[model samples]
Every structure is written in C-alpha cells, then in structure tokens.
Target: MLQVEHLHKSFADFKAVAGADLTVRQGDLVAVIGPNGAGKTTLFNLITGHLTPDRGRILFKDVDVTGLPAHEICRKGIARSFQIANIFPRLSVFRNVQVSVLSQKKLSHTLFRPAQTLVVEETNRILDSVGLSDKKLDIAGSLSHGDKRVLEIAIALGNEPELLILDEPTAGMSPDETTTTMDLVKRLATEQGLTILFCEHDMDVVFNVATSIMVMQHGQTIIQGRPQEVRQNVTVQEAYLGGA
Candidate 1:
C-alpha cells in the first residue's frame, strides 16, 4: 500500500535518513525499530509529507506523493499519531475527535452549524473503535496519561485512514496500559484491515505485534524480516539486542 524508494533526507550538514527503502503491504503490521538518532522518525516525516526528501520517491497506492503537503497526504488516506499526546487541553474528548471528522470533510469553519450535531454519530463510532466511547464527555486534559494515549489514537482514527502511522504508541504507559494499547493496535490491523507502520522502542512490543520488523542503525536499514529472522540476525543482535 505504501512504497518508499531510495529515500534520503539531510539537515544542513548531517544526513538523517540515508538511502532508506521500504514497502508496507495492505493490512500488514510493520515495526521500525532503532536506537536514538537512527532516523526512524525522519523516515516517517518524509513519508507523511512533513519533510520533503532530497532524493527518491514516495508512492501511496501507485501515485507519487513525495512533495505533497501533509494535509494532502492525509487526504490520500494516510494518518499519523505523534509520540507525544497531541490533544487539545481545553476541549472535551468528543470535541477533539469532532474536529478531526470535520477536517476530513474540509469543514474547518467553527460556525458551520454545531460540529457535534453534524458529525456526532461518526465521531462516536470512531471513539468507540479506539475504546474511548465512555470518556467522550470528559475534559481531555483531565484524563490519565494512558487514557490520553487512547484519545490520541481515537483522533487519528477519526480520519478513517487506510494506512495508520503510529509513532511510539505505547511510549510512556504502564505495563497494563502498554498491553492494552498493543491489543488495540493489533485489532485495528487484523480486524479493521488497516495497514500499520509504527516506530517503537520496546522490543517485546515490536516482536509481539509486528508482522515484520525493520531495524535501523546509523540512518540506514540494517535488517528487515520476520520477527524470528530479525531476532537471530547477527547484526541486529550486535547493534540492538546486545545494546539493550
């Protein structure tokens, strides 16, 4: 569903992503695992159109989207969630999701009737999918950290993306919360048939949830294969496992 060929991005004097190539098939759950400065996020930025690649092409479905704007890329059915909780502090959970639904319809005008009334059914369905239906009326800022993470996912789901890019979905959660988040992500991929590409630090989470894994080191792909294949790779062991 997504193809990135010979991608490269540099910042002034440093190369963040160098000659990276990857392909994510429909309904596949792929994990991009690497240490700090491994350029995982940089690759995501380029794919999502937050950063334009200096070289190579980004093809979504079959069309080139290398230089497209972020919103344009999103409209093409790719949605991303940040490593941090990117939620509105003052808005209610319902309102936050309603905004995403409205944006998808190009209804940015706040005065375009009441957004809640306009997209209430659709917003509730999205929130329900992410397991946040009960918290819809709660103030977003008042939710616990774990709940906030779920809310972030809910907001991303509001776009009804074909390919979901989650940046550290389980980043700061407790053990239980991390497990819950992983389960939700798995369901999204397997049941909802959404293709998932995520950058994660937790080895257990990556191995457990990823259908395939790509290991990056020094801004380059070191290994790409199934979990068992990657786990036994000599270079992966030396670079990531041993370091872990």
Candidate 2:
C-alpha cells in the first residue's frame, strides 16, 4: 500500500534519515522500531509531507506521492495520529470527532446549522469503534490520557483512511490502556481491513501485534522481517533489544 525507497532527510550535518526504506502492504500491520535518533519519526514526516525528503521516492497505491502536501496525502487516503494526543481540548468528545468528519466532507458548522445534526451517525460510529461512545458527551480535556489518544485516533478515522499511520500509539499509558489500544489497532487491520504502519518503542507491543517488524538503526532500516526473525537476529538483539 505504501513504499518508501532510499529516503534521505537531513538537518544541517545531521542526517535524520539516510537511505531508509519501508514497504507496507494492504491489510498488513507493520511496526517500525529503533532507538532514539533512529529516524523513525523523521521518515514518517517525510512520507506524510510534514518534512519533504531531501531525496527518495514515496509511492502509494502505485502513484508517486513524493513531496505532496499533507492534506493532499490525507485526501488520498492516508491518516495519522501523532506521538502526542492531538485533539480539541475544549470541545466535547463528540464535537471533536464531529469537526473532523465535517472537515472530511468539506462542510463547516455555520450558525444556520449546528454540526450536531450533520454526520451524526458517522461520528457516532467512529466514536463507538474506538470505545468512546459513552464518553461522547464528556469534555475532551477531562478524559484520561489514554482516552485522549484514542480520541485522536477516532479523529483520524474520520478521514476514512486506507492506510493509518500511528506514531508511538501507546507512548504513555497503563498496561491495560496499552492492551486496549493495541487490540483496537489489530481489529482495524484484521477485521476492518485497514492497512496499518506504526512506530513504537514498546517491544512487547510491537512483537505482539505486528504482522511484520522493521528494525532501524543509524537512520536506515537494518532489518525487516517477521517478529520471530527480528527477535532472534543477533544484530537486532545487540543493537536495540539489549540481548547479549
């Protein structure tokens, strides 16, 4: 569904991504893992157009999308959630997602029609899928950190993405919250058939849920394979897993 080839990005003398490569197929749940400064997020930025690549090609569904603006890529069926929860803090959970749904449909909530009546079913369905139906009326800022992250994901779903990119989806959460979030991710891929690519620091989370794993080091992908292969590989163990 997505291909990144020999991607490179730099800031001054520091190469954030150097000749990196990644491939994500439809219905596949792929995880990108690396230590700090490994360039996972930079690679994501380049693909999503937050940062254009200094060099390389990005293709989605056989079309060259390199350097496309973020919104254009999003409209092309890519959606993402950030490392930090990005949501409307002051809006109710329902309105938070409603705004996204409205934006996706290119409509604005004018005084003539409150957004409340528009896309009601679609908004509720997204909230329900993310397990936030009960909290729909609650203030977004008042929710727990985990719920806030989930809300961000629900908002991403508003874009009706074919591929979902989650950066550190469970960066800060309780064990239960992590499990809940990962379960949702798995369901999104297996049940809903959404292609997923995520970068996660939690090894257990990556290994447990990912259909494939890509290990990066020094700004390039050193290994991309199944979970078992990554777990046993001596280089991966030494470089990132702390295996002797």
Report the lDDT tens digits of candidate 2 across residue range 31-145: 9999988999898888888889999999999999999999999999999999888999999999999889988888866634555465888999999899999999999999999
Query: What's model 2's lDDT at 5?
Result: 94
TM-score of each candidate structure, all chains considered together: 0.95, 0.96
lDDT digits (tens) for residues 1-244 of candidate 1: 9988888999997999988888899989999999999999999989999999999899999999998999999999999998888999899999999889888876766555575466888898888888888989999999999989889988888888999999999998999999999999999998899999999999999999999898888778887888999999988998899933
Instruction: Count backbone overlaps in model 2.
Output: 0
Cα RMSD, model 1: 1.9
The segments of candidate 1 whose C-alpha lies over 4 angstroms from its true place after superposition are: 108-118
Give residue 111's error in model 1 in angstroms. 8.7
Candidate 2 error regions (>4 Å): 110-118
lDDT of each: 0.90, 0.92
Best candidate according to TM-score: 2
Task: Give residue 61's error in model 2 in angstroms.
Answer: 0.3
